[model samples]
Target: MIQMDLEQRQSSRFVRPFQVTNHEDETFSAAFEGADVNLTGLGFFIDDPDLFLPQQRLSLRIKNEQTDEVYCLEGVEVIHLRPDDSGKYLCGCHISHVTSNQLLAHHRLVMTDAETALVSMETSKLSEFNFMEDGSELSTDESDFQEASMALNLAVSQSESNQQEVARFVQSVESIFASTQSSDMKLQDLKEEFEDFKQYLGQMNESTIAFATLAKLLAHTPAEPQDKLAWKTLISDFETRFLSEEQQVAYDFMHQGLDADEALEIAQEYLKK
Candidate 1:
């Protein structure tokens, strides 16, 4: 099986070594080096997730890793933040604006020997995982499609229709990409690819959605750090009660007499498909 990086964002992120020397904020002339974990002309993932706020805009000066090329991008929006295992935050931003020349320059600078090779290898794997290919990618044949359907069946054993639904979704994606492969590909192809993935993700089983949401929330939220705060809050009245599956699982776990930390861990795993 091809290894798939759970690309949680819409952009195709290239995760090779790169650096950004930035007065990432507007007010200071002084520059700081943020961890350039992944680079794309579209946006970047900066370190220190807590340092930036959601919906914030930044100005950055990015330096090329393999050469002296440097470029500046402004009005980059801090779209979302995810935490890595090392206790640092991956701050994702959107490149709201850039000139044509700057865009070309950034692309050229990032297409270094190491990054170029890394992108080519990863893109091949990603193409297999998605069941589509252009000349630049690895094609998934009919047998590969059958394997995928079988995998889907095993994954969502709760319902045969779930497997059928997902199989059809994948086939439609294959058709779209195959049709587009005959012509010269454009940025629109990228857009369509993401739309297809988003649609597939939306149609995922409840357990999968719940698991992904939990994965996202745990990576960012602080409420779990303290035993006093539950990831899900409880509000009870004389009349009615409201709680999510996560909340209910957590509540039951607590009632069974486990400590907060242990209960949280078990609840999270239980909700995952």
Candidate 2:
């Protein structure tokens, strides 16, 4: 006969259905119904009792049904297994090593269940008190239940506050991303405008160089008075087509008494504006 040891619990057990996947291949890996869990121990029904043995350590991934959160319980050793009336084994297990965060999550779950139980008890007592003919004062148990309910409400409020903080943080990140994206677009537009300005400057430089080359050639080459007159007319037409009003003024200054350097300076000053 397989001896079943009595369960020793340090914390109150809460009925919490969860999917349990066994890390080892020897036992069944499936979701067990009618599972109860505390901070350090778990009890659930299994189809085969013989598959599990006492002191057999197993790693388990437990996913909570209500919260949809998964918890890892390592060094989970089987303590006992007893045959139930429904032809299934009630396997009891103890968690040897549980991290602080994991313990806290389990604690919260247990607290939530305790709160629910207190509410149910309060409802039942209230109904009984209502029907009673005697106008009795509130019992000590009822007062205690109310106090516990208040604590649970406080915990729930804290949880809500934490959620609000997280939401605010996410909103802040989104705002920063939007601002950065806007800056990038502005920078791209500025770059394109700068390129267009550079192209305009390049075309002006090319036109200036062509005009200077033609003027130098006309000054050095021998020509008749008619040829010189025709050349001057061509130059005037070129100035009218390619040069701005400011540039034309500089050219007239150069033809008059002003030196070439002084006329060039005047043209540069006008172009700067």
Candidate 3:
């Protein structure tokens, strides 16, 4: 394992309220309490350091109690294993391989924790300065104290805003995943409903044409409400389940007046790579 002194740490570690489970070992306990997490790695106590070798990979599930956010990391490489005085080993590991979405969520979680720590640090620093004194020289200039307090308030507000945005993004991604699964389960029913509506529309158009060609040509008829609903559901289901990220971009480009052939060609090239 790569060893380093405490002063050589690359990222600031914080004790956030989150739980982690080691999927590799069933006998490992004390998982619900939480761990020390930073931007890059996690430090958790285990029963034995001898069980883990240098550079060993582990599967872990981390859940943040405050946010109720869960991240299941499939690949994490062990950086070091140290036995503490309590007889338990402190396992240090860094995330190695994870999907794009999971990585994004993990990064956001780390950022949220780091931002909270920073806000706390700034508040503590501001508290150290004596802004008001009873007929005595202030330890810090009043204007300077005001500016520092304002800056701290602004930082706290900005951090909360960023956290809300991250939560919304994660929620939307989860909703899409749920929608995709639900759509797949009802695909056959949706297809049948769409086909039935198409047949009915065709029959009505044929009759309208037979009655009077000119009237039919001039008519601006709206689709039935049920037909519109079915069509919308089918379209949403198709786009969500079948299209890849690259293909969806190409599809949007086609609707925006780009040449269909060019869009298809670009999408194909992306898929090939």
Candidate 4:
């Protein structure tokens, strides 16, 4: 209960229905045909077959349920996401290029059918990334970055066949990023540490390696010019490295029926190790 606000006047509305398709891999697909609330853009409890990390951006196809009009929203950034007691994941997203306030009237309402679809979809038919389909200037670097995030999310979820190794790798990457963000560490020492571990992830496959790279990309929450360009280059590097590797891990883990606690434990053991 984060104080849901329905009177947001600065953005889009109408409880628009949506379809989230994978931009690169067709493995991941989802939709939202739910209520529209004005919580600074929109929020949906996306029934993602795969878990999405914080700050993930993807192409979102939003439609007015009644009118059947589709609005393609590219680079829809996922601001926040968490799960409830029923093993469902909720994603609060901000749709870009959707600034117009289309709906004139506002009221408290809920799209139970759409919400239910989002909350209870089969995980078997989803992946973690989506890109722009309309051929808009979707950057190569951005797509690479998203691909990396997808890999990390999939590696930790039930869909990853080799969950132990993926979790271990993700934990290490998060630990590495955490070190870089530490205030107590000397700048020179941190640089040296970064240089030492820089190629460490590069040697691994794209998805596992992205665990560190995406952290590196998202390290700048509010994105600066230089850092933005720098991160994009690095994200491209992540894809290149992934393509170079043999990728020993199989890609058959989504909706595999593994216990959530077990998967989470392997991925959360970085600090303890």
TM-score of each: 0.33, 0.37, 0.36, 0.28
Would you list the C-alpha lDDT of every candidate in the order shown?
0.44, 0.52, 0.49, 0.41
- lDDT for model 2: 0.52
Task: Tell me the tens digit of each residue's lDDT in model 4 across 78-156.
Answer: 6667674556665766544322111111111212344432332211011111212233222335644454444456445
RMSD of each: 20.5, 40.4, 26.1, 20.4
Clash count, one per candidate: 0, 0, 0, 8
Index of the highest-lDDT prediction:
2
State the lDDT of candidate 2 residue by residue for 139-158, as single tens digits: 23343344333323333433
Predicted structure 1: lDDT: 0.44
Model 4 alpha-carbon drift over 4 Å, by segment:
1-29, 32-36, 48-50, 98-273
Model 2 Cα shift for residue 13 (angstroms) = 2.0
Which segments of candidate 1 are over 4 A away from where they belong? 1-11, 21-48, 113-273
- How high is the lDDT of residue 5 in model 1? 35
- Residues 1-273, model 3: lDDT tens digits: 122333333365667777778775343354644557654467777786677777898888777777776777766778888877777888887655454334334544554543553543332211111111222222223433443333233334334444565565556555555565667655754565556656755544432222121111112111445433432342333234333455455555555555544554575677778
Ranking by TM-score: 2, 3, 1, 4
Q: Model 4: which residue pairs collide?
A: 15-36, 23-130, 23-131, 28-126, 28-127, 159-253, 159-254, 206-242
Those runs of model 3 whose alpha carbons end farther than 4 Å from true positions after fitting are: 1-9, 24-33, 113-273
- The full ranking of all candidates by lDDT, starting with the best, is 2, 3, 1, 4
